[model samples]
Target: MAPSFGIMTAPSQVDYADVLRVWREADTVPEIEHAWLFDHLMPIFGDPAGPTYEGWTLLSALAAHTRRLRLGVMVTSNRFRPPALLAKIATTVDIVSGGRLDFGIGVGSRPSHPLARREYDAHGLPFHDAAYAVAGLAEACTLIRRLWTEDEPFDFHGTQHRLTGAFGSPKPVQRPHPPILIGGRSSATLRVAAEHADIWNIPGGDIDDVTRRSALLDRYCKDIGRDPANLTRSIHLPVSYDRPGDTRAAIREAIDAGFRHLVLGLPAPYPADVARWTADELIGPSA
Candidate 1:
């Protein structure tokens, strides 16, 4: 089978128009399966109020323009939107795309990043303890999945979210909902992915790093009686436009290391020549 590939339109300073251009161009390529965005209310770096369009809204708009491409965030910050509403939005996007949706999500607010904390502070969102974050993510995974698949309304009670007779209507177009890609590298994260995710997404790393982490995820899968083979492994690769060969090498290596899906990142305002090269050299043959 051909390798599945996707792109992350750099979520920084680029205007939404250029992003729409990229997404439209990328969707026409058979090699490109999906386009991803980051869930951030504020800029990840530089100015906090940078020109970052909302991820969900962007996907919603992109859905109207594209034909075959799937839409998703690299991993939505679960705290950025409430669980049930998030599920509703995702289902709507899936419907719009005619089942072309890959629903990726993760907990919000990284402890190591002060900017994330600052973003949360500015928005009055809590940066909770690690335990709370992990447990909440697990519960969220369960709730969202249920919301997408359940026929009857159900009450849900969890440490971070509670719903009474939650009636998530218009179930997703994909059976049992779209594939959920769980993100993060910590042990808690791996465990949650093993239990709930159809795909496991981690930041791109060297061959040895991918090997080591793949083994770790396998262990987590077995501990819970889930087969590791059932989970699709993906890497988020940050590529430099000047280093095309480096991008190809990393992608080839990741493919050799058993990663089936790639989340690719290009520089903002991707140059025309570079984008063409990405399509011809990197993505075309892989597909």
Candidate 2:
């Protein structure tokens, strides 16, 4: 099957609810499955001091409003919330949305992003080294998945911390939990994805970069005795095409490189012409 082209709307510039609605309608128009939030506490490149909505809250509201659209954060920072609490919230939203959820997670360390750095400073979150954050994220992913699937309370010892009598309630609506989508390019991140991800997302990479990363991920899966094919591969690309052919080439390249899903980030309030064009033909192939 050809890859599905979903949208990830940045919540920094528009009313977040309106942003979700645009993609919710897009899902129906284009027969797409997933719609995402970029998971930033503040506007990144635009109006760094302006307001930005929380992804978890926005997702909950969207869950109530959307019926079939699978919702997710393109890549959520693990620093924003505790694993157990995040797990519970995700489960609740999954139930509310009738199981349309794709939980994508990643490390929170961002020394290069001024917006995230500002948030960390204001919120008193320690700015740890990249490796430290990725390691913590791995542990969080393990703990969150266990919380979603474990039937009995058990003591869980993570590298960074431990949980006692750990078990989650109302297990996620999707058995074994909603597909965990892990995103990043680093080796450590890929290993965690290989270990815990149902979908390993490659964020903003061209064909060569994506193929290389996919190969690296396969190596990690191999080291763990995992068949890389078991974990679906996806690409999330920032896109604005004056010509449909440009986006079409990108989509085809991703598919040919072995991605099963392609998430295209659009300009805020994705222009109707662009949306219709994508629905008509800009994706991987025949629509």
Reference-based lDDT, each prediction: 0.84, 0.80
Best candidate per TM-score, number?
A: 1
List model 1 lDDT by residue over 1-287, tens digit each: 45788888856788887888888888777677778888887787766677777888888888888998878888898877788899999999999889988999987768788677777777887778887888888998999999988899899878779899998889999997899999988888888999999999988876797778889999999998999999999998887787767888888888888989887887786776444566787777554
lDDT of 2 at 145: 85
RMSD of 1: 1.6
TM-score of each: 0.95, 0.93
Tell me how far the alpha carbon of residue 262 in candidate 1 is from the true structure, in angstroms, after superposition.
Answer: 1.0
Error of 1 at 160 (Å): 2.3
Residue-level error in angstroms, candidate 1, position 249:
1.2
Q: Which residue pairs show collisions in model 2?
A: none
Instruction: Flag clash pairs in model 1.
Output: none
Local accuracy of candidate 2 as per-residue lDDT tens digits, 1-287: 55676877777778765676576676566456678887777778777777688887888888888777788987888988888888998999899888999998988647786566888877777777988898889889888888998889989777776889988998988987899998888888998999989998877656787798899999999999999889999888777666667767777777778887888777765665555556676653523
